[model samples]
Target: MSGAPEDLAERPVHGVRGEPFRRLLTTWTATSVADGVRAAALPLYAAVSTRDPVSVSAVAAAEVVPWLLIALPAGALVDRMRCRGTLVAAHSFRAVVTLLLVWFVHSGQTGTFVLLGCAFLLSSAETFADSATQSLLVSAAGERELERANGRFVGAETIGVEIAGPLAAAGLFAWRPELCFAVTALAFGFAAVWILRVSPEVEPVRAAERRSMAGEIRQGAVFVLSSPGLRAVVGTVGLVALLTSAVNAIAVLFVLESLGLAPSTVPTLLVCTAAGTLVASRTTAGLSTRFGGAPVMTGALLVLAGGVAALELVRLPGAAWGAYFLMGFGAGTWNVLSSANRQRLTPGPMMGRVTSAYRVFAWGLMPLGAAAAGPLAEVTSPATVIVVAALSIAVVAGFCAPVLRRSLP
Candidate 1:
């Protein structure tokens, strides 16, 4: 189904300056900060609690496994529900879960199982929030300003999740684990409040047009599969995510054991990566516009591969920092361009479902990659697994290049 002509015409001509877009950005930034805290805290806590690679990686796996389990259903639900309400509810749920996690940590019940359960629940909430947020973005910024809006969104995410969030997590986790979680809960609460202020230009689906959940889901899947461009983007992204997860699952371990960095320094190292993402957030749109989306994306993957390979081969703290920065830059560029392209291609009513379907293929493999990393690292080394992942990403880039060149604008 097509969007209303009036809605299309009424989109802000001034880029992402609309009130709805501002509120959505605020909401996303708050949520990103909360996510960053939990993300950094979990692995750090797990590493200290148990040195077992499998156990540590299991925590990482639990967080992303929801993408596989609930992303599609959540997307369908988001399409059916109001985006603002869905976001509010999701954030509220996350706040409650985080409070529970705080209680667990305070009670000295910081077991692997407890961490895994909390991570899974929190990530499940994220699935809904993310799907609804993407749908909301379309309404807030419209198609014309999607690249700029997404660039700002990615910048917020980089700063909040990667920079501010991790830094805060490091300090708070160092001070008291429960304190870190308490802060995360507060962030989620704030996000709920912020999103409530957004007044998006929503066009509700008519009752006559509504279908069964399964049918809607199938329709989304069919749409994604039928488009060769979407298929190439989805498949390439899925492969990249799989390999990247393997590298990330063991990253903390690599820093602590291989580089001999202190726990406090870990977040600082992460900040370097965030710095690169911040740079890309400002530059990706122009780069894509000048060079075309396909070439930029393909080159970004190559840059990421180079970063990982450098990290493996060099093994110095300075080199590690630069490598991560390069990796983040490449990732940020690819993410912004890919998301804008997808949003541009999709119909308004189908946005949520299509986004979810895309993610089911793109991000669903993350758990498998993360889960395997620990065992693989145990057998060889974190460095070995990382380099292998880098090589795999490079290979996928080569195979997907021609399709991306042909399909992406």
Candidate 2:
């Protein structure tokens, strides 16, 4: 497919170079660097500046908990506001938060408990920016281009969030903790400027009576529930989310206890996963375009099942890392198609709510899996968790296989 038909509203995603996609990639990379700093700096800040684990944990949770708590209202706000403006404002806020941390750290006021108050404020801004930028992608790419657009965004984020970003943090943290945060502040400032340049072409909505917050929330939830395609994809992603969360929490314990490996080995195993992730991203374009998103999703789910199953019976250290990489491959595959499919199936105005609803569905069960793992491990052994998780993926894939095969992109 050289290009989509000229008459079509959205261009065909033959390759990954829509203007918005390019800029989005650039913005994500910069922001990812900032994230990398924060990821490393958080613990370092506690270790050096203060020794209270509770405060450190609270700060960490503060960064993520708001995603679940405020996602819906944030989505509605995205629907009402200019997405680019919202994103730019969000980034500017992130810069301010980091700068405030810098001031406190420099002033020797970086009390562990005190910092968390700042973190909570920061998380609120993140909630706004993340929801808005996601919504903006819908307009910039249009419907036909969603999969490719989202794939590109995810690929960039993977590098920024998963790869180079962390590496940069590790390097910077060796020097000074305050320096790491300062760098974060700088990244967000640049990102905010870049975001200001993006203006998504929002599609119009028809006149409807204003509703209460509860009604708005229900409207968003009902919209997602009513869409069969969205429901199926959301269901599959949600299942994967639970298993992934468990495995992530357990992989460390597995290596430490089951394999008799030191904690130092964990990053090497995780780093190896980039191979699988990169391979998955490279192939997604061809697979999604030729076979359609459903086929790609099914194949990816099967790979996920196989990889998770492999974790149950590994005997060698090399094989352990190999399994991690393969699992990462499956993770890459599932995320690529599923995220793209979500964007493709949803309209622009609903992107915030839909994305939030999808996030809630996928992540809501994570605590259950994370919490149950330790108890389950004590009883049935760590391998049991791996086995059951693998089996779950296999069963879900089996049920979804037929439905997926019948539906093309």
Candidate 3:
């Protein structure tokens, strides 16, 4: 079968140059803020509902498990549909879901099950939205400009999702729990409207040459497996996700119980992480261009490990802030480079499925790591689990550094 239209090739495409990217960027910023608020609110609500570490972690696990279940199918569907329309629909669905959560919270009917169900539904929608957005990004910003584009995207995400969103959610949650969901619903609706303003460019696989859904899914997976650099990227991402998921699962508990801080302090600490990420996003492209991809990637991982380890050893709040900031910087560097690298490696037609397949292998471990964290923290202490996770991350970074240095671009 023929590839996507020449317009959809790796070269800069018409119609998506100026306005579309701005609209997409605006949509992404809105969605990121909403997602950040929800991310903070859900775990905080769970912790307030019940102090059981297992139960609390379960809520975090629910947010990401959909990636394991539906990411591949979602990616395939995105490839078959108009990305702009898909984004619109996904954002609309998320808005409705957030509204439902608002109603549930207002009615005082929320439980762990309800929280889990809502988190899962939201994430399921996100699976499609994220794939569509990434596909759209490729069209908007061609391969030659991917690093710069991704850096901007990552910077906005860090600011909205990690910094501004979380800070607002914490204040809202503290004042009135339902307010958090209400703001999130509004953000999603705003995003849906703004995304509609993006150019209605269609880049789906041609109907005449379209393969079966299963075939398409396998094709994307196969493409990723066939490339050594992609293989290394996926492996490293998976390991990093696994370890980081554990830390995220228990982060609230660690802040509240371990550090003996107020719930409000959670977002304050996250801001530190976001600060680091913002710096990394701005610098990752330049660093990679100068030093090479492998060293930057490996060094980022080491930095993350150091941050995680510091969190366990230090007992002071200032120390925790610094550690989280370091972790965010490391994570930010890895995320921006990896995303740009993946987009550069994959063909335009296969972008959706390949991105989804990449996530299925890498992010699919998030739930497992989150679930395991609860039990481990229950048996041991949260600090112990975090330290162990940090060590594992270090080990992976050390082991993969040489291999990636040799393999990656």
Candidate 4:
């Protein structure tokens, strides 16, 4: 079967270059901000609800477990459906879920278990939504423009999640916790609307064979594992994700307890991180295209290592901001290049499954890392845990440096 219209398929999707692509970016931006607000609020809620690092980290761990548990099923579902409609439905579900959380918070029904349940529900929906949207972008933008398109998406994410959403959530949390959830609900609702308004000029080619779910999942795994480049990328991604999760699991607590900063200022540190990401977004695509994805990834890993190391040496809030800023910059580059590379390597028909499988390997371990961080912090200090994490990240980077240089384009 023929794919998207030849003319539409040939067109590039950059900033405002195509109407449908622009609409997709808008939807992503809005949803990201909403997610950012939720990200900032949930940890704070968990921390406030219980001072135990394990309990607080449990909330974070619950949110990511969906990636490990439901990502494959969700990807299989997405591959068989209309991606756009799937995205809208998923976002709508998130809005409802967030609103319910708002009600629970308002009624003072939010305990640690309740909060974890809500996070799991919200992220389960997100698994489907993210899979569908990423597949849709791959089908819409075409392979040649993958890096550029992903860069734009990452830029929007940095702005929404790091800059606007966190800052807004901080203020709203100070005023009212329910207000933060309410805003998240509204953002998801609006994201659904904006996505619904998008009119794709092209359609994806559907798979003619009606394969069983298990068959499809296996096919995607085979494709990813057989390819050296994908294997390298996934391995590197998993290690980085683990270390990053470890650091983030207690970042807010570190700032408040270790650095003696007020809770109100945690979001400001996040904003600083976002600012660095924004700067990286502008340059990552060009750098990847020029220097190749591997070298760029290597450089980013080193920068991230440096950033994490810096956090140990400097315990002040200002110093933490600078360290996180560097980490964000590295993260921005890695995300854009890695996503684009995955999109480029995977076949269109298997995009959803392949993406899901990749996430399974890459993000599935995040919960474990987070869970480990808490108990480790209880044994040692958060600062000591982060320093160990930094050393681990550097080791992963050193191992991947030569492999990535050999494999990635």
Find the 10 residues in a row with the least total lDDT in model 2.
7-16
Clashing pairs in 2: none
How far does residue 1 in candidate 4 sit from its true spot (Å)?
A: 27
Of the candidates shown, which would achieve the greatest lDDT relative to the real structure? 3
Which scores greater on lDDT, model 1 or model 4? 1
* lDDT against the true structure, each candidate: 0.86, 0.75, 0.87, 0.84
lDDT of each residue in 1-66, candidate 2, tens digit only = 545565465633333466565676688778876886687676667766667777777778776787
Candidate 3 lDDT over 1-409, as tens digits, reads 3666664664433332466777888899999999989998889998997787898889887986888888999999998999988998999999998899899989999888888898999999999999999988877766667777788899998888777887899799989999999999999999988887676365888899789999999999999888888898999899899899999999889888878888878767877888899999888989988998789989999999999999878777489899989999999999988898898888877888999999988877877898899999999989999999999999999998888877666
Per residue, candidate 4 scores C-alpha lDDT tens digits across 1-409 of: 3666987676554333676778898899999999889999999988986787998988988987888888898888877887888888999999999999999999988888988999999999998988878877776666777778898899998888767887789899999989999999998999888887565422333567758889888887788888788999998888888888999998889878877888888767777778778878888878977988888988888888888888778766478889988998988888888898888887766777888999898877776888899999999999998888888888888898888777765
Clash count (model 3, backbone only):
0
TM-score versus the correct structure, for each prediction: 0.84, 0.91, 0.83, 0.83
